[model samples]
Target: MVKERNKSFIFYFFVALTFMMTSLFPSSGYAAESNILDLEAKSAILVDAKTGLILYEKDAETALPTASMTKMMSEYLVLEAINNGKISWDQETGISEYVYKISQNRSLSNVPLRSDYQYNVKELYESMAIYSANGSTIALAELIAGSETNFVKMMNEKAAELGLENYKFVNSTGLNNQDLYGNHPDGTGAEEENLMSAKDTAKLAFHLLNDYPEVLDTASIPKSVFRDGTDDRTEMPNWNWMLPTLSFAYEGVDGLKTGTTDLAGYCFTGTAEKNGVRLITVVMKTNNYQERFGNTKKLLDYGFSNYEMQEIVPEGFQVKEQETLPVVKGKDKEVEIESTNAISILMKRGEKELYQPVVTIDEKLLTTEGALTAPVEKGTKVGTLTIEYTGENTLKFLTEKGDDLIKSDVVTTSNIEKSNWFVLFMQAIGGFFADIWTNAADGIKGLF
Candidate 1:
């Protein structure tokens, strides 16, 4: 009997312990997860290409080595130089000895360059953009700024102008300074590598696409021969395998840059457009070439499936209490106001109703009583109407200067002319008599 009781007690004790453990530490299936994505990368982000709205992010602000992806800034500067007329497509430039040595390394992504030969700006840029050629990148940097050191300065300055945060540019090429064969740009450490946050990477890509969309024309080329028909010609396959013609061809995917290094692992900045909605994604520090693209696919899939460009508030919308503003000493008592343009944002599915419109009138244009002065013209700029989202998972734009996102101009719908002096005098007289009658009526009621 005692043995039976002991066995029963032990079984009950074990059962109690199991229940306690289950309650204390819930399974992943029952736990509350903050991230919607299951990415296999150290850091990642998804952004709306048009609005710069960050749809999702995972440790996106932490700075990490960017590997060859640093070339995007170089590409931006090159495009800028071209557009500014500082350099033309057919402009010829000769390679420096440093660039020549880098080109012959063969181990690095490069095409053969001869010191005696002059290559046009277009061919060198194609080599850099499509193949991530370190030598060609430095050559373009030199062509624009006279030297790689001066070019590095230009890169950092442009980063600031573009609102890129948490970034450092040690070289025009993304290669580690050590790879520069003891000729690394002055004022930088020998072992230091280029660094940027995933958010900043997305921001850079954003400005690149928006500022110079023509970049896509070159970036989209999947395969081309550098110096084709020449003895030094070499095959240049785009590192971005997500191109429509590549092995990992994803629908609507094109025109991006990829990076790989010992510290950076595998990284990719990818963009895709489907149904007029373009999304840019960045994945950093993945295990291999495949993992970077795989993680990017997860981000893009989530964005394309869950979000869309939605016009939350129609154009010419009027706020309830702000429908009209009183005009002092005017022919009209009040002037109507409405939004000048439609307010649209990349919103998650079924969440459009959660956003509310907030209107702010310009205080300087109004009197102390919140009335506008007379002579308010039609289409006069009154103020601004902005949307405030009241839902979960609200992500901010990549830059703080994103006031234009989900915001619209509020202006007067009709003109208000000033009243004549005689009319104003008559209104004052009438108002005085109306006040007197009101006071008399109140006095009579009190007597009763």
Candidate 2:
């Protein structure tokens, strides 16, 4: 009886295990993976600037106010102005009444420079970036364009230039209406909405790093003592906590921007590089501070750990060495296409050999003077070298002919016309042989 009971229990155990496996595992027809499988944010994106690949994104098109991050463009415009020689870093800016009002409000980040005091352009940018001070941004705006209105105009024009289709800037400072006094009297959101999307923000950040990298020099400072014209000591600590904690702790955490407001939650644009792989991650509208950092860490860790930047087309790889490609109407039966720079790819571990490069060129359909005249230029639209895996997954890369390809001006050996008189003598000899053969054939037919 005990043996029968044990057998029954074993049968039940097998049935239960099978049920769990079937319920837990994904079925064949169901989706096993998606770009954004798990994320909790209004918007987010992960992009590799070097490769210009969008690894993952969600709600990238939704435009929303980006709060203090608007200062990124303000910083962009300021750098452009400085590059154009409109203003120098040492130039002093008077603390106007508008700055005084914004400073006294305390609702905005301010270092409290006296209205009569004068601070240089350098000091104001420090406060604007480190403390997210509203007053310093206004002063810099006025200094750059003679007034905040003109500066905002320049900001929009730069935005247009940057191809920010879903962005608009109302003020250089990202201070919201709730932080200001009067019915739009403080000029907060007085113009249009200071809005942006995740993709646009990433693009802006990428350009800022590539175009004006000095901003990172300022943004990366964990703590800076700003000595304005006044004696009041306002120490501006970097709002980006990761700057200190991750600068040394995390592998490649570099300088970037952060923003927050009642309406727009904590937003951050962070950049990091490891093993020659650099990427930008943007997280916007997180409910809390921990989630912002946590989500960023999760995304970044996934990027760094899961994906590796692999070179598919290594430098000095002879394009012709891969396979003997056929060429028609040419002295040499094959032409070589080589990679100029090593083509890099981001892929999962153990997948480095998953790609095999293939080259494509135009059809050998045209010829000039018994020589091929293929319309191929340096870096021109040749053919693509695509890497394919076992399945349908594939990535295409461009393979170009080496820059030193011989010109089409080379003389063809099989010329139909000869320049020398010896060419005519040979043609007459060949005609005599042809006539002798024809006469012999005609005499044989008459005899027959």
Candidate 3:
């Protein structure tokens, strides 16, 4: 009876323990805590520029019209051409009928390019970015790739190269057309043309700011005016309002693109840096200017107020010191390994030093059997060195660390192929006499 009572007590204890464990874990539908947005934007994303961490996102991947923000990619390609020497900043482009007709329409932004007039690439790019001029965009596109049709092909290819799978480009200028739109009267283009997502726009912005920071020279400008090189100075006003309206604008909020269309509403891709932390926020498809500015400001305020950029890995931070890794059946017995780079982790201020960093390396990658041959480069990526921490997500790439591995030539000292009969005989006789002489000396020392 006592044994039965003990077993029943154990069963009750286990039941209580199970209840505690279940209660300790969060529910399956528990959401990550985030600030709620006031204005309704179809899509939005906030990302850490340094670490590429998505801090907050709402419908970021949903495809929508990007409006004049498409020119961001256009601007990137044009800048690349200038950098590559395929075109020059001062290179002149003939004003075509396409450019002339667009200038006559007030609805379109133009620099008043006459049919006989020639405008330099610099004026065209400035006009396109500052005023969102459709004429300059088309003229610049034609000059770069010989025609806008061919330029669109390059745009698609470049988008593919940048891993923007969900994006498609129909025209350099994101002008809406009814024929292109399906039966939906919402004015948004069909899914097949002139569409992109907030995430991809952020990705493009990241690459542009990182790869070609000079593009901001045009995007951040308050206003610009240019003549069509025919004596008539046409004034083009910048549509980006953030430069004029905000007094406490973050210092690094210099060079990002803004866009708007009847169908896609208004969109802004803005970046700001405070202290050392840089953040990029994308607000898309807002109803009006106030909504765009308010939503973007809210996103930026949330980022600057909450998150920070912390250098988890300092400049000299190393996972492993230079050590020899063994090699088998090769010219070398061991190879030298060193840390490839110093990685930085962007997180909140206090959160940086709180988490434990776990270092991991692949054993197979470290091994240098037949995989690694002699004369490996100094900075070749031999193996991945990962630093991780515990958080809302499992572990992310602080940076993709790799081995600064170089091959060794330590096996040459073990050569055993040489054979000489005379030398061997002389060595044997010398060894015997030497052993006898050593024994005699030892015996004399013993007697002493």
The numbered model that scores best in lDDT is: 1
Name the lDDT value of residue 184 in candidate 1: 89
What is candidate 1's lDDT per residue for 1-448, written digit by digit as tens? Answer: 9999999999999999988664433222201221656788999988889888887788888999999999999999999999999999999999999999999998989999999999999999999999988899999999999999999999999999999889999998888889999988889999989999999999999999999998899889999999988999899999999999798888888778999888889999999999999999999999997898888888877778777788878989998887999999999999999998898887776677887999999999999999998998999988999988776445588778665877898999888899999999999999999999999999999998
Higher-TM-score candidate among 1 and 3? 1
Better model by TM-score: candidate 2 vs candidate 3: 2
Residues forming the 10-long window of minimal summed lDDT in candidate 2: 398-407
> lDDT score, residue 388, model 1?
82
In model 2, state the lDDT of residue 291. Answer: 70
Candidate with best TM-score: 1
CA lDDT of 429 in candidate 3?
Answer: 85
- The candidate with the higher lDDT, 1 or 2, is 1
List the RMSD of every prediction in angstroms.
Answer: 6.7, 8.1, 11.9
lDDT against the true structure, each candidate = 0.88, 0.67, 0.66
Q: Model 3, 381: alpha-carbon shift in Å?
A: 7.0
Model 2 residue 149 lDDT score? 77
